[model samples]
Target: MDNKTVLQFQSLSSLVDPTFWYSLTKEKIDNIKLSDVPLDIYGYYSYNSLQSSKSNDNIKVPSFLQLNSNSLTNEIIPSFSFPMKGLLKNTNTIEDFQKLDKKGLFEKVSKKIWDSILNGEAIKCPSLLNQFLLISFSDLKKYKYYYWFAFPALLLENPIYLTNTQLLSDYLNKNELQSLHENYQKLLEIPDNIKKGIPGYFLLKKDDNNHVKVGTLSEWEMFKSDDKNKTIVGFADPCVLPNNPGWLIRNLIVLLKKKWNVSKVTILCYREIAGEYADLSQCKLMDIEISGEELSDNLPKSVGWEKNIKGQFGPRLANLGPTMDPNKLIESAV
Candidate 1:
């Protein structure tokens, strides 16, 4: 198994040297031995284990009456994930880092992560991390900029399931359901009001029982059978800007066509964005509908978007649907 290692700085001053962070590459990172990485203070604790420990400790003693008070108050040193070696293939310079620091980009990124944690959106592996290198030229005309790299820690995973039938059933009462449906319609009427856009794709497949099962790309990667029988459902949040959804769908279609035998392609999006992509690709378009029940399963256990109340559930459903054979979709379309 490939070792997954992350880099840590003992102090912020270490960042003063631009080469310190930017020079790291996949080769260098992969060459890193387990001994090179700092040991986690609490050892490796899975999400459930950490929660159980906290519960047990709380039950055993009162907060003010703990025997090891210092342990509870000790500050956890802040650390960021190092970019995976090959992931950011761009060559960068030290001057780039210096300029970014001067521009306060580091502080801005730090604060963004801090604010997220404060709002209860815990960072998690691969999800919280940006796999790309952000290069900012110092001057566009002069062609100068800095290379800034941030590797968020592989935090405990937070799993979110859109298909939590109980949770969905309890949360969406008749009135709430109607309001949700109405809100979806309103967005279709006036998409300008949707400021925050979500990017995701869907797949529709039939299980052995022939019951339709809806899933996301990530889920399909895990559960898809070798046989070709699937449909690709392209979706974008209504609030997403017009150009982005079309671009995303086009990219998805190209990617799916290359990897699988996709049959028919269908897009569920706002009318305006749907129209834009309909001409670009040979696919079907459907009205956007928001339903908690339809999208109750095969969702990431936890996502960064859930940090906001508005992003909790409704938006997720509209973006996810049943799984289908990608090859069949492409073949059928062709």
Candidate 2:
């Protein structure tokens, strides 16, 4: 298949309901802690450069987004000011905001103050008249709150699998696994190097007609589909491992084991750090030692190979080799 075909096929699988996505989005949005907002927002109002110090971790949002208490209140449609002002700035970045940095951000906000944010005790500060620029002017649109705090939950949902016994059993009884099996068979028939296999973990279902359905993109597809514009970060030998990658990998395992009874699953890493971290027993990981020579080899040209780059197959194969950057190799695999 050509590049256009590959990209079009990828877009086909990624389609999802905007409404359903919004529902899932709103649940987490409602839980955002007031303190998880940005310090610059306070700067907009109080003109307090000191507010910048509120971020204990030096976290901030994109330089463009203007955050102000009045605007935040209007966006969230809250009746009061937030109790944990320091915490918002403390856990400033988009990622940090997701977790709300509860303990750290709210170290100063007393329970009473915290409750008030939730209870709407703090009224909108009139001093910040310029709030309209930062917020939706219409009361109806005012509910469009920005909660970086809720992001982690949404991210967590990104890799979510339908592993509940009932959901899995029903989907499988309907032919979900069979479809993947068919796809795998079709993939193997492709004539080429078959360079990689990045198996995405997901719940499957098979129907009486032997049709297969997937809860989400296969493991290979998820990582293979990483946006080309974004820099894909893998753990390098030079630094301590980031907590998020480990958590992400662990979640993948949990999803597979719970949904598909995937025991003794193997995950090969293109980098030494990934392999090293996989060595940890609690993580129940494994490593594929990639060397410089192995990384330079080209992928196979085959029918299934066509989709592999668009999916996880290329990266998986790349992980088996060490020298090449996994993300770069996969992007070029096609």
Highest-TM-score candidate: 1
Q: Give the TM-score of candidate 2.
A: 0.18
Q: Per-residue lDDT of 145-211 in model 2, one digit per residue for the tens?
A: 2322200100111222221111122223324444544553343343221111111222223334566
Stretches off by above 4 angstroms in model 1 are 1-133, 136-199, 204-213, 218-232, 235-239, 242-246, 269-334
Name the 10 consecutive residues with the lowest summed lDDT in model 1.
Answer: 40-49
Compute the lDDT for candidate 2: 0.23
Candidate 2 local Cα displacement, residue 14, angstroms: 29
lDDT of each: 0.26, 0.23
Error of 2 at 330 (Å): 48
Cα deviation at 187, candidate 1, in Å, is 23
Give lDDT tens digits, candidate 1, residues 78-156: 1111111111222233443334332243234333433433332211211111211232222212223233333222121
| Candidate 2 segments whose C-alpha is farther than 4 A from its true place | 1-247, 272-334
> How does residue 28 of candidate 1 score in lDDT?
33
Predicted candidate 1, C-alpha RMSD: 24.8
